[model samples]
Target: MSTNTPAPVGSSGKGASLARMGVFTLAMINVSAIVSLRGLPAEATYGLSSAFYYIFAAIFFLIPVSLVAAELTTGWPQKGGVFRWVGEAFGTRLGFLAIWLQWIESTIWFPTVLTFAAVSLAFIGPDQRWDEAVSANKWYVLAIVLAVYWSATLLNFKGMRTSAGITKWGTMIGTVIPGALLIVFGLIYWGSGNKVDINMAPGNFFPDLTNFNNIVLAASIFLFYAGMEMSAVHVKDVKNPGRNYPMAILIASLITVGIFVLGTLAIGYIIPEAQINLVQSLLIAFDKFFTIFHITWLGPVMAVCLACGVLAQVVAWVGGPSKGLLQVGYAGYLPRAMQKTNKKGVQTGILFIQGGIVTILSVMFVIMPSVQSAYQIISQLTIILYLIMYMLMFAAGIALRHKEPNVPRTFRIPGGKHFGMWLVAGVGLLGSVIAFLFSFVPPDQISVGSPTLYVVILLLGAVIFAGIPFLIYAMKKPSWKNTDSANEFEPFNWELKKTNTETSAPAPEQQH
Candidate 1:
């Protein structure tokens, strides 16, 4: 056999050195770009106040989840990521289910987010009746929806490099840039003697936790922040997993909070709560702002950016979750058909299945009387699925501490083992349960189906969809396990010790 020259050895501990990352970049990527969209007309539709209630709602639920996710991700960096972590914590079945929920939710989520982009695209002018076109001929929206879905699907076929490029630029240009401009536009209007009558009086500013609607709204917001660990899968790929992970979360969190607060304030300044259209609300704000300011020219430009952002968001969603699901598939949780991968390592089969499911869900636009109704209906299923995943993930966080007590972790929750892990896990558990309970109550405003129909759909969704994994688990056997891939990721504790030796960090006890 012809032998290539032996590669030179890297410096002592040089391989481990490659694992460090700065906090800011990690935070920027982990922080959400989509939070502002939910805060605008969406929160108003749920009857939340702009100030006290909405932000309080987020702090109690969203913020904690982000922190918890950051801690777990840094602690456990694996190829399967969440699946591996949860599997080690719980069992193979529950882990499969966790990844399943994450994967399925994204597919269901496609139609809803795409509709947001389509509505924003309609903002070009009074002349372009995109929304009217969608309503008048359902197939028009269906076609565009399919176009977006397939385009996103094919983009991923080139592998994650294409997806990453989209996510990075899409987030900056599509999310941050547009969000900042909206705030600036609102501030300028306020400076020009245009007063927006916002109901920020004490009572209105605080969200009524006692109110069923507001409580459910908070639950919904909790799910909106559910994907904090979505980027956790990338930890191993980063230059330095441990340091970069937490930093990235922190950076992303700051960006997310700024956008939510400022963007909502902008919307409130431009349009009153009652007049906000849950369906086409962003446009309403832009329309009103443009009309008063006479910068009508920027309307379409913003719409284009928003549309491109939505497209990027869709691509991100499409690639991320399906890749996780593909992991689940390789674990024998899914049929071998789904395990097919191309030379470049893209999972073409799963992408097709995801596209099909999205298409089926998209047909809801035709059946539901209003597009907003379709959004609400499809969204309920997504929330329910997400809550189930949160429950498993939270429980896994606690279980991992006990089951793999000696596992090497870059960061562990601060409190003593008995208290810290339980406390953090408890918060996630409680929030998830509360979200699950409230998901059944149809929103007071949007009506996709009757209250009875909502309850039936909720039960049907929880039982049928959640049951899919059990069937797969029942079919599992020793042969189902792939011997080659069975080797779990083991942190190089010796190398870790040498690296931390300079800092005098204590050696961690090795787990079996």
Candidate 2:
């Protein structure tokens, strides 16, 4: 049976073929992956020593993930992005799970970041006691964050044109400016001969091989660097993805790692680990670092900038994954309500649902003793979901070689097909497994939650979230395929059509 459902189309009519993206745009996206490196309150506790783990993570985790994504993305530059790539390699059910996990994780992370932004701003308010009160109040923090987050969501509802405008300009104003300011402030502080605690010495910059715990810490921090591939979803929009994709990933990786190495060093120089506000450490570093340099005026300026950056981060995430999952939903994996889009091309329902999820998770903060504990728990759950997505990606990449042997590939991994498959799939599988295992280990700096609770929360999160896709798959019924529906939203169009003449004549020989 042919279902005549019109496929939901995203901006149709291909724009001009993209030329190679230069270092600037590449750096912008890369910065998106690494900007969260600042403050890193968790890392600060091990003294200046944890910076080494970050460097290691940049090497083993971040770069390889980017490379794997570049290959997959260059091969299949389609609307669905990761969901399509993985679904093509695996089946639709698994693909739905990939996007679902990605979308869900972002929802969980929204509150933690907002709280971090709130805490950062609170420090600058007059009266330390009042500052403490505002920072500690869960309801107040939730209200402020929800307000900012929902506003950004509304802006995104205006469509990609508006969202892209904000993202492009916001990245510059929010991230690059603040980052450059940090570097400039650090130089000024050093030139003035102020005593700085964190060592920027050449030897300290190198990875410490002897410390196993620090190695694990780097592995933990490395997970934060996991989103490089997420930006690659836009590779098709880049002028010439083949060359530009690799170039972008390479340049972005270096710039991102450099910023992280330098930024962390600067933070360490200014503050001791014990005094670090793991929640708002980056702003804390700015406050203290600016004070030491006698540039108190810059402190509040940086704080506002940091808050805007966090807000922009929330805005970008609020729309991005939901957009991906909306693709899956409209394709019949989800109900029709999820398919609804307003005039601005936003899935308002999904946005509202995401906010609701975040609001629910925000309540967890009240039960949890500390913001860091709640933040870590939520982030860990996100990591678990992310790992499941990565595992599917790896499997899909490998499956494609066998299933579509002659499919045109613009940018194949350098090795022979088998070698390439093994390398990409193997590394992805290993890194994801390691990341999942490490997700349960409580951070060393603070006792945010008990080990028993942490393990249970993480395990339950992974199982329950990951199980949703399977349930959907089991509910699916086979139907006639529609060639026109190759990338359409309806799965009923996916069933192959049968001809009446062939059906009538089919059993003649068997009867004789």
Candidate 3:
């Protein structure tokens, strides 16, 4: 198959055309994928300094990833996402590793987000104490997580059309509406002269840099901005991607930061720092705000909305990285069994395998000492795994500048020569490396049981998950490749170059 073929276009019965997406739609897609209200409460505990973390992460992680991905996606515009970009830069082995981390980090991340969904569902009940009790119950959390996750996986089986619709509505009702409401309530509270819990002092806006413990939770901010790269896959779909992608990123970043900062401040305004619970704080903040507004009845409605948002987020993620991995599998990286697709062309086998992993991880709720600890541990693992991929991605961005200088880029980072690529991607790489190292330090805010266990789990988990792609690459058989020429994955550029060089080399001197 031709590697450089433009993305397929259509306008007929067998292949109805997809309308090209514009800036607003793409921006909202990025918003839906990256903005999770649940994280606000944790950051809220940082008071004014939360804004610092938000801005820092946006600059170092969010913007860099989005810009780098835009360049890469537009330049390649191929079936594989990171797999294609990194493969072109480094080679297929590291390329597979990048996509593997993307998929697996997201896979491990399912339980933590679902756990938040379970908590939101728990709060739908009348009694707050009863809600807390149910939320804390490992069995209930596991049951809800599995039910919601598997349900989403099954729904995705229908195809992207069904999934996209849910994400759009889910994000509106669940994320945008709730965030706006929280900010409005905070405004009303401040306007009404109720005391603000967070210090507005100028000095408090920046976090204390000296304390390592103080900065440990900041590592997770990278995760808060993690999935922006996922949206880059659609760079080809956007009109004038060079212009539109950056506009979308700018608009989406501002809106996202606004929602996060205001939402966190709203929660901090209502719930005291001591009372912030990672899973329940967002819901609790909503409940408290509604109580003050004398709209206690809206509490359950907010719970349902947030839960829907979480479900929508899950549905989006469930299909996304798996689709990329499926393309790689079709290219002969995975065993033949993994490449199976359903009637709708969904990756049924891979989706089921993903679900199975989620199911196994959800079971950890039962074995861990507490649901919160389990959530923290899984979240940290996700962050570290994803950071490794980001490191590879940033390095790949810089390397590609040198390796394929003449490749036409619709958009390029600003500086001349390697300077722009290095500055943007270099900062991202440095930030990711710092976060990855800091991720090993357990936050003192929670009782993670044993520091030794936490370190061991993270180190081992990263090793095993990151190492699997290499093992798969080693075991890959030529027979595993899809025989259909149309569906075949394009070989890496390096592979083609090596072939050309070998073929052009002068014949070896005769032996005698």
- A best-first ranking of the candidates according to their lDDT comes to 3, 2, 1
- TM-scores for every predicted model: 0.83, 0.85, 0.92
lDDT of 2 by residue, 477-500 (tens): 433122235346532211222254
Q: The CA-based lDDT of model 2 is what?
A: 0.67
lDDT, candidate 3, 1-512, per-residue tens: 00011112222433222254778877777776677677777787798899999899888888899899888876777678888889899888899999999889989999998998999999999988898899999999999999999999989999988888787678778777887888999989977989888888999998889988988987888888877776676666666766777898999899878877887888888877877888888888888888888999999999999898888878877887788788889888999788889999999988988898889888878988899888888999999989989999999999999999988877777789899899999999988998899999988877788989988988988899899889999999999888798787877777888899999999989987
> On TM-score, who's better, 1 or 3?
3
On the 0 to 100 scale, the lDDT of residue 269 in model 3 is 84
lDDT of 1: 0.66
The count of residue-pair clashes in candidate 3 stands at 0
The best candidate by TM-score is: 3
Once superposed on the true structure, which residue ranges of model 1 sit more than 4 Å away at CA?
1-20, 32-39, 46-48, 128-137, 162-164, 191-193, 232-254, 477-512
* C-alpha RMSD by candidate, in order: 8.7, 5.8, 4.3
